[model samples]
Target: MSVSPGIDRTTLRTTVAVLVGGIAVILDSTIVSVALHQLAQDLDVGVSTIQWVSTAYLLALGVVMPTVGWLQSRLGAKRLWLAALTVFLLGSVLCSFAWNADSLIAFRVVQGVGGGAMLPLMTTIVMQAAGGHNLGKLMSVVALPTAIGPILGPVIGGLILGVGDWRWLFWVNVPLCVAGILLAWRLIPADEPGRRVRLDIVGLLLLSPALVGLLFGLSNVAREGGFGHPDVLLPLVGGALLLTAFVLWALRRGGEALVDLAVLRSRPTWSATALLFLTGASLYGAMLLLPLYWQQVRGTDALGAGLLLIPQGVGSLVSRVVAARLLDKVSPRTVAVAGFALVGVATVPFALAGADTPIWLLLAALLVRGLGMGMVVIPLMAVAFVGLERPEVPHASILTRIAQQVGGSVGVALLAVILATAATSKGSITSAFDIAFWCATGFTALAVLLAFALPSRVGLDASAGGGTPATGAPPGPAADATEVGKRASIAS
Candidate 1:
């Protein structure tokens, strides 16, 4: 597949600017995770109450994400990005000054609104600028936060709380946000808002509540009883029904729909979307498991848990350069398959980790696991856009992102249930960890299976300009739809 020729200096600066913004959003997510305990004490609230520090943000994020496609079309990418940065910055300041639990949760909502829009916008900006050819490498740079945040967030949060207060977590976002806003204004090119700018108000209403209900339901299940409780069952069933209704509605609207379900007619897109979900479950599920093991099982403090995770981040960083270079040369199928296999292998040691497991051994396991994560991230991200038209990138981003986010919510819930169940047994902490690790392994294996859905080749005649395909080219439904179905059938 052709890489887009090197970008001009101006566009390069813009890309960097957008990447900085993307990193800021990632950093926020991880940084807050470490500060939950401190925030709870500061506000004199229970863990459950302070938990909304993250939950509120997540809820707002879910509510806002579906609107990104509509907003970008209405406001243009640059304007939307700058507006998001400005809002995020203000939210950070408000959070820093929050006096109580209720107030902090309120500010987090503001932060979420902006943060939710940031991710899709980030993907849209870089992908559009790259114009498709060198996507693997471009995505590597764009995906740096996935590698960086898990390593940096906990360490930074620990240090901040160590030196000052939990408020520092919010303060940390200040300089980053300021830098992001200035860079975005200076670097991002202006785009004319497209003519087809009608907002999908109906779809947004349906999708938003559906996502919120689903996440809320999962969080409930994570808390105590399973979905047997009315609280969980109501939202879970309602969310499912709402999502089903929206799918039916989206199918009827077709091209004019909010999500553009038509894109799934492409076999590669469908496979990539599935892989994204599994990756989220495998990766984020591990993320949830590791820190808890460190803090609860190994008796490490938050800082120590964060520090142990650094090795994994290092491995991920190392893999990025290699993965980016190899992406265009080899099929994503091969690269992604290898990546998930490595990830599954890395989890074996953790599956057997005991109370006295050596630090060096654990770090070694993390290094390899991190490497696997890097492998999965770059290829998965790049492949999603491989055969997509430029105009379709936003649609693809929304679909894959929704899959990953929902997957993460489900993953955390799954781990919660596993931990709760294992805790009830007479098994040692090591035995419990073994169980969670096995689940993580299974998830990675599923991702490996899903990778086969990706095309085995890079360049295809399906799209043009290595970026946007010809406008009037028949949609995938008209092009080998049966063949696509055959591939899925064969794989299953």
Candidate 2:
């Protein structure tokens, strides 16, 4: 049989099953970011109360991630995923019917609870099923929601708000969740629950509150008095102390810790997690800045800004197949370096962009920026799992995701602070944005140097249960890969 040049059938089906349900969670974020004003007005609430709509979800997500490994071992992947999906569906329905501000905020916590578990578990399940094969290709598939959600969410939100009923935002998730449930039930292979792991109650007490405090603090950074504000400073300091304590506690426990800090000992795992933090900060900072430039500088509405950002998303989509194919030829270091270079170079156009910059020119740069953004995640994930055991994959997923999310909040907070300060100093909104974009570009440039730390052409010893991460191109198709796909097709 001729070898296929993509993810095999079994993996593809599982990917689809997870992504169908997962897309709504991601889209919900960007979609809601655009609709905050509308929500505040419709709910008859102030900015602080409505801000919780987003902040509550983020903190809830952070709180649940550190415990995902224990949850998966206790509940099994299939059941946990189903339960999470069902809860998210229920939350969406409740949110649609919410009559008051408090009701919506409370219902949002329900969504966040379900969403928090879903994000990391989605990766753990898919990575386990992929079984350490063709990971670069797999990430291109795995990273789909990340790529498309930012692209489509705003556009969808704009269209929905255009309909004048804010509740449709929640209603929109119903059909997707229903389809995801049916597909997951039918397509994902079933597995017996693993041996029950003892819960790390102390670690949970330290870490969950640590994440919540830090994120909640950062969420307040863009507002009055910046980081020095009492609300921002207090949570940040408290979060840091708690996080430091959790690190010490986790070190003492090793594999027994709630999050298994031992995974960071591997070269690939630590490097990828650190690099993902930088990229997450940069990418998310840029995501925040791009639409703002259009709205504030160019005078376009949210919908028009969303429409223009499509080329970047398209560029990311175009790069996946090529980047996956390239991993078969070069080290992940090469791909990462090249990708960061594209991101850094592409960002230059934005730093230089003025109110009068040609629309077509900016659009072209977005396409390149997207290509680079797309390439970064592939190698980070491809490298991270290189030396991990099946059990270790869940911990690594939880760790990397938390790092990225924290990094994202950090990025948004830092950049927002900078923009506010910049705007005040010169009263030149244009110059303030230019400075912020340049800083965004600086973050990507740092990532390029760090990319060199990623292990290149590392050879895996499959003799042990742990395989070398597929960092180099494989010699050819493994004897079992096609057979696995065939079996998967037949079974489903």
Candidate 3:
């Protein structure tokens, strides 16, 4: 059957199948944040020990992400997706049966292995299937988990904790994974196995540890004595050195590296990556602050704070269709600039407001913040792949995913440091939150500046009758693959 110029039935089914699995991963990521205290109490572990439940998951995720492109190439999309889903299902079941903090943390790492691969692989498969047409609309569909996860994850966690045992948290994922695996088997097309690609062992050694070190160091900022602590400084510095080594190594290996480093040369690719970093810091860093602000300053409980944040989620949801249309009609630059500016403006109220600022006003600001986030994130994600060929899309997805993940970690750490330093003084929690919001505002402001570097319109080589090579006239195969692969690998 001939597919439409836009999304087709097969595409929609593929997207849905991917999203079903994707949602489970997303929810699991955030849902456990609220359960730390409960888990600590239940397991008879200190807060510090129980916290590894989240930390171990994050570190495992960072370690696994760099391997996804190679793994996908080795296994094909359908097999990889089912394997990841099954691993997650197994991990979730193991976690539910954990008898101690040590066991749970180990189980969480297992879950992270599955989740880390699923994150980038989801995008790789979807975009490859879409063949790079109607990206703006497709991205809106892809972004649904990210938009709702922050707002709803905590609420769901709270509800689960409110009624049932802590183990139910992991148990919830069982049904989702089961359903996801069954649906994927029924819906996703099978791929013919390709020739085995040798794993980039040396590059993997350098890059995976680099990511682990960096994420571990960043995760310690709030708990350790800020950047000055040896615990934080050693890993952060070590990670940086390893990452530098990996870059040099990848450059030397060229297309053969675990992650292709050549994609950074593309103006659109690098620019979108930079913007995604800032967006991550702004979105996630602010998320760290918002719930705490309500709970600490306003004295709302966890569930209440989550409920209050629903306006932001609602705003994001409402704006998706409109933002998708705008992306199709206007330049991504225009939409992104406007979106970041809106985010900056919306954040100013939180930065300047007093503790007693009206509830309705804060909620309204959240709505606008959500709207701007939708606008900024959708286009930034779509623009990253605007001009790329099919094979390169997987690498680009991995690159963008890494950018956003690292960005969120950095953002959270920076704000955490700021809040910690500010809180030590004899001022109220409100002042600390205000200062953090100002810092977040600074991030959006920077993103607005960077968005100018994004492609002014959709598609690479638009003048040459823009579309994927599959849709338009194909380019010279050898030259196009080499260049595209280089850039895509670099970006990944």
Candidate 4:
């Protein structure tokens, strides 16, 4: 009944049920990306308008992420999760039937609202169920969807497009949601109606807009004027200001604020958050470029690029077993440092590669990149939950989740600007890609240094955090941005 230390039947069952539901949310993020062109053409909408199909979903995620912890307190895990999943199922059905770009965009927002809750809630539910033992192994299992969704979604989307229509994208989620709903209802232990925690309307107002500003700002970077454009600059500035205000409010409000800042007092949690940002850049910023590099420079189609990227996903899959085992013996610091180093070293091929750089070599490098990414991510995700009490799990999840999500957005946006400027100044697209890849390497390099700051192993700082609501200093890193530029997967 136990898969490993502390992994019992209930824990394993919970993980499976959560992942089944979560995968629908994660896959839907990237599956629609490749179908944008098709949707635009079919709907008789401009590419710019059709793009909202993705953008509205992304912005919805950004807005909803911070409120998850509060919502969990109000609804209890079982009830909240089902409500969110059902909402996503309804949104998916609505999306398939959408008659116009406007309707589709609205439907996507509905899906994002459900999805935004599920990812963070997935972590909280499983970690709470496990009670914080054998985290490395558990995280490897928990994070599988994040590892596979973005990589495989495009390939699935391409094939669906080849054989069917774009609406099939939403239709695909129907079965998964139904299965997830049934499994959850049967397997998950039900809880009493949750506590009567008051909603922090003021904090919600400040934090939601702040996240929206940041995500919206970053999303605008790929448009004209790059980072300098008002769309990009204004939101960045406004989000930063509002985020600052929210932190000050949370400090005063203590645990009553929409998201309690006390969990960040733990060194491991905060430090891992910062490194996750860099890893976000390494994971997502590079993802943005890799497929484009192949498509534009090597003249491959979307499907071909997705196929070539699979080795990287495979490497991540391969590393999970090794990473889980290593975490049992080695320090998270050692595992993370080595992982970042390998990721940095592996990125060299892409940075130095020319147009004709052998396909096999690039694929080989991708495999290594995936391996390193897996190693880095496993520890980063697991280390945050160390020593925390069950109640605080949601708070920690929100902190780490938001950090990576924001980080991914920042990473994707930064590289987009860097690539655009470099192309203009260097007058060579490949050279620009090279420069951007080096910047990504620089992210891993920084992450390596930050990884050293993580607790050498789990429980080293458990006494300090003690997993209480008011334990740590105010939160430091937010939104280790996940999703592709689709907010990427923080999987934290």
Model 4 gets an lDDT of 0.80
lDDT of 4 at 49: 82
lDDT of 1 by residue, 348-381 (tens): 8888888888979989989998888898888878
| Candidate 1, lDDT over the whole model | 0.76
Q: For candidate 4, what is the total of clashing residue pairs? A: 27
**What are the runs in model 1 whose C-alpha is more than 4 Å off?**
1-10, 460-492
Against the true structure, candidate 3 reaches a TM-score of: 0.92
The candidate with the higher lDDT, 3 or 4, is: 4
Q: Write the per-residue lDDT of candidate 3 for residues 1-492, one digit (tens) a residue.
A: 444356777767787888888888988877887788788899998766876887798899889999887887788878888999899989999999999999999999899999999998888777766676677888888899888787778899889999999899988888889989988998777664444668899999999999999988887777546798887899999999999999999999976788886767667778998899888888888888787778777888878888999999988887777789897678889989988998889889899877789999999999999999899988888888766655566677778988999898888888877876676662566777788789999999999888888877666223211333222122110000111111111211
Q: For candidate 4, lDDT tens digit of each residue in 1-492?
A: 446664677778878888898889888877887787788889998755876787788888878888888787777787888999999999999999999999999999999899889878888877766666667888889879878886788899889999998889999999999999998887776764445568899999999999999988887777767778898899999999999999999999987888888878877788887887788767888888888788767889888888889999999988988888898889999999999998999999999998999999999999998999889888888898786666677888887888878888888888877877777778788888898899999988988888889987575224322232221112111221212322211110
Model 4 bad stretches (over 4 Å): 1-6, 460-492
Q: In candidate 2, which residue pairs clash?
A: 460-468
Return the lDDT, model 3, position 330: 87
Poorest stretch of ten by lDDT in candidate 4 = 471-480
Candidate 1, residue 5: the lDDT equals 50
Model 4 TM-score on a 0 to 1 scale: 0.93
